[model samples]
Target: MSEPVSALQGAIFEGLVKVEEAGPCGMITLRGDLASTQVKTAATGVAGVDFPGQGEANCAGDKGLCWMSPDEILVLCPYDQAGAGVAAIDKLLAGTHYLATNVSDARARFVVSGLDAREVLAKLTPADMSPAGFAPGRFRRTRLAQVPAAFWMRDEHMFEVICFRSVAQYVFDILTAAATPGSEVGFF
Candidate 1:
């Protein structure tokens, strides 16, 4: 098999904040009973974070897990480890009714960093991006303009956004436009 590359090849737009297409990030769409100890142990062991609560994203080092829904979780790890990550989880819950699929290549990741990053994202997503409302560690699976997307904070000034690979450019376009130098909303 050939090596995988990101949907957008090093795309970057720096305005009020820096909007850049990030490198491949390993993602796993893990669906099962979030409340089961068997399921929770298998997932957290692989992702390196305790399973996140509703709308929460918890991480340890470069690995993490995001709570997508009551029965769904998004697993994150190094881009190259996604396949193994899935296999490990599968093996751990072999007899359970669970599904762990590697979705690393189907998604695109973008990094928006700067003081105005939250405002840049606020323009595109309806989620409360306010400092006190949507604090770090919160994961939002919402619409970025017309497309479905998800985003979380890396720090006070840096946010990471993810969307389907097919709509990467559109998402990037809207993000950059929202980050235009004179368009700062100062909402955060």
Candidate 2:
């Protein structure tokens, strides 16, 4: 099968905020008991990073593990490593009631940065975008423009947002419009 291209290839645009496709990434959804030592150990071993605490994300090298819920996590790695990542995770959790599936193709990631990145997002989601509330390494499963989405800060100036592939185009367009000059939706 031909590798799927980014939903917005070379279609970056900037206004108050800079928006760009994060490119293809490997996303594996892991559903298991986080309280189990074996499960945690197996997840870390396969992800090359420790599982993040609730609402947090931990990155080691190119791998990032985001805590989705008490019993779920999303592992992010190089696109090419998705299959192996899933297989390794499965093997590690052998004999356990676990479900590990690659969801890379189902999601699209975008990076929103620049001085107004947070401001742009504030217009879309109810999430607290202030530094005091939603600091770096923190993540939230929220809606953007009424579309289900999730995002985490890479730092003070950058954030990565992921949404369903089917709505990637709509999300991108909404963000760009929000980031456009004179479209400021003041902070809450």
- Candidate 1 — worst ten consecutive residues by lDDT sum? 179-188
For candidate 1, lDDT tens digit of each residue in 22-126? Answer: 988999999999999988998887888877889999866668999899999999999889989999998899988999999999999999999899889888888
The regions of model 1 sitting more than 4 angstroms off are none
lDDT of 2 by residue, 1-188 (tens): 78768777646978888899888888999998988887778678767887789999887656888988889989888888999988998888889899999999899999999877889998889888887889888989999977999999888888889999899999999999889988876663
Evaluate all candidate structures by whole-model CA lDDT and list the values in order.
0.90, 0.86
> Which candidate has the highest TM-score of all?
1
What TM-score fits each model? 0.97, 0.94
Q: Which candidate is the best by lDDT?
A: 1
* CA error at residue 36 for candidate 2, angstroms: 1.3
